[model samples]
Target: MQSVVEQFKQTYGRLNARSLGLLAELYTDDVLFQDPFRRLEGLGALTRYFAELYAHVETCSFTFEDEVVQSQQAVLLWTMSLRHPRLNGGQPVVVPGSTHVRFRHKIYFHRDYFDAGAMLYEHLPLIGMIVRFVKERV
Candidate 1:
């Protein structure tokens, strides 16, 4: 089980369009994946979702900082360093988040928790300033 969790982290950290085919090994056929932006059901949908996410991305990588495993579930804390053409002036931006995964033989469900503003909203031009201001106030 812990091995599965490690594989999950390593696989995702190096994930790319070409490597998307590896999803079959890390997820079940009916895997459910959700994040602040969208919810994807099934391995096929997951592939498409990732394709779109990385379309404009220049580079993206993840670093797992912490983890906790119990039974069929695991929680992993990670920071994603991403560089995209339309975000943050194409410079790398880091966003901290966590994922909760449940699996039997392979991951059947995965949920990601992160601030959308930090990953997207705060990287916009005008909206970025406003979002940053609001975040500072909070």
Candidate 2:
């Protein structure tokens, strides 16, 4: 059995689109992914979700700084960097988050985490304004 840290260490670190595809190979057809805005099920849905995110950013990558890996459960402490031309190119929007995965032997059953606001909405111009307004008002 690959440890949680090992799975991440082997897949991430030098992340690219191809690496993303490789990681998806570890997800089952019925994978479940959760985040601030979306609770998506199945690897197909997960792939589409990730693809849409990649479309908006010039470059995207992740680095795992800390981790806690058990037999079937793993938690990764990491930061995702995205280069948004509208926000600031190459400025790197660093959002610290964790991906908690439940492993079904070699594939993932559940994999999810992260703050959407910090990673996305806060980095947009008009969108950021709306987020701030909504936060302040609500």
Candidate 3:
């Protein structure tokens, strides 16, 4: 029998430009997506949220850097690069990102974690300056 961790890898590893269905398949109907800017509930919400979330991105991709798994929990560490509207028109932002997945019903309950500065604002121009300034002061 496949371990829960293995199951998670199989479920999420197949993500691509057109993997929304696969993503929905891996998330429960009530899956909750928690992040710094948004907190959404249910697969419907998640799907809708992603549609907007992905709109700003012209092209995006992820590569798993590492994976730590145990029993029913798994952490998928990844490196992502995306085309940004503000950041050099698609500069690749290399940062450490992780997904904390809890498995149930062939899906995840929670899978979110990333540094906004490292992945987003920091890659932009004016926003990056402000973010860096705030970071240095506080």
Candidate 4:
């Protein structure tokens, strides 16, 4: 049997609008998912969130780097390459992030850590300039 962590990586790598159904295989019915932007509870909400997210993206993919696992918890480091027509001029934006997940047969809790500015704000036109300036000054 494939470990949940490996299953998660595989499922997310191929996840898209069409592949949203795969989420059911990785997450429990009442799973809790949180990221920098929002917190979601239940698999239904998560599916809607991803649907909206993927609807606007031209392409998105993750490259898993490292993982630490113990008991029923795991932390996986990854870099996401995303392309959105409204952000970064439809070019790819690479954001480094990590996921912490707790699972039994399927993941029931998940949290993601990443720089929201790098993923969104820094990719916008006007906001991108301001964010970059602020970072440089800081």
Question: TM-score winner among the candidates?
Answer: 4
| Model 1 lowest lDDT segment of ten | 1-10
The local distance difference test score of model 2 is: 0.72
**What is the Cα-based lDDT of residue 33 in candidate 3?**
74
Query: What is the TM-score of each predicted model, taking all chains together?
Result: 0.93, 0.78, 0.79, 0.98
* Candidates sorted by lDDT, best first: 4, 1, 2, 3
Candidate topping lDDT: 4
What residue runs in model 4 are displaced by over 4 Å at the alpha carbon?
none
lDDT of 3 by residue, 1-138 (tens): 766556556655554445667666567788777876688888988787776777666667667778887766778887777776777656666666888877755554675788878777877778988998999999
Kindly give the stretch of ten consecutive residues in candidate 3 with the minimal lDDT sum. Answer: 11-20
Q: How do these models rank on TM-score, best leading?
A: 4, 1, 3, 2
> Deviation in angstroms for 12 in model 1?
1.0
Q: Write the per-residue lDDT of candidate 2 for residues 1-138, one digit (tens) a residue.
A: 665457656766555554458656567788777887788888888778777766656777787788787877878788888787766434788888888888765555655577787777877878888887888988
Shift of residue 51 alpha carbon in model 1, Å: 0.3
RMSD to the hidden true structure, all candidates: 1.5, 2.8, 2.7, 0.6
Candidate 2 vs candidate 3, TM-score winner = 3
Q: Write the per-residue lDDT of candidate 4 for residues 1-138, one digit (tens) a residue.
A: 999999999998899899999999999999999999999999999999999999988889999999999999999999999999999999999999999999999999999999999999999999999999999999
Per-residue lDDT, model 4, residue 62, is 99
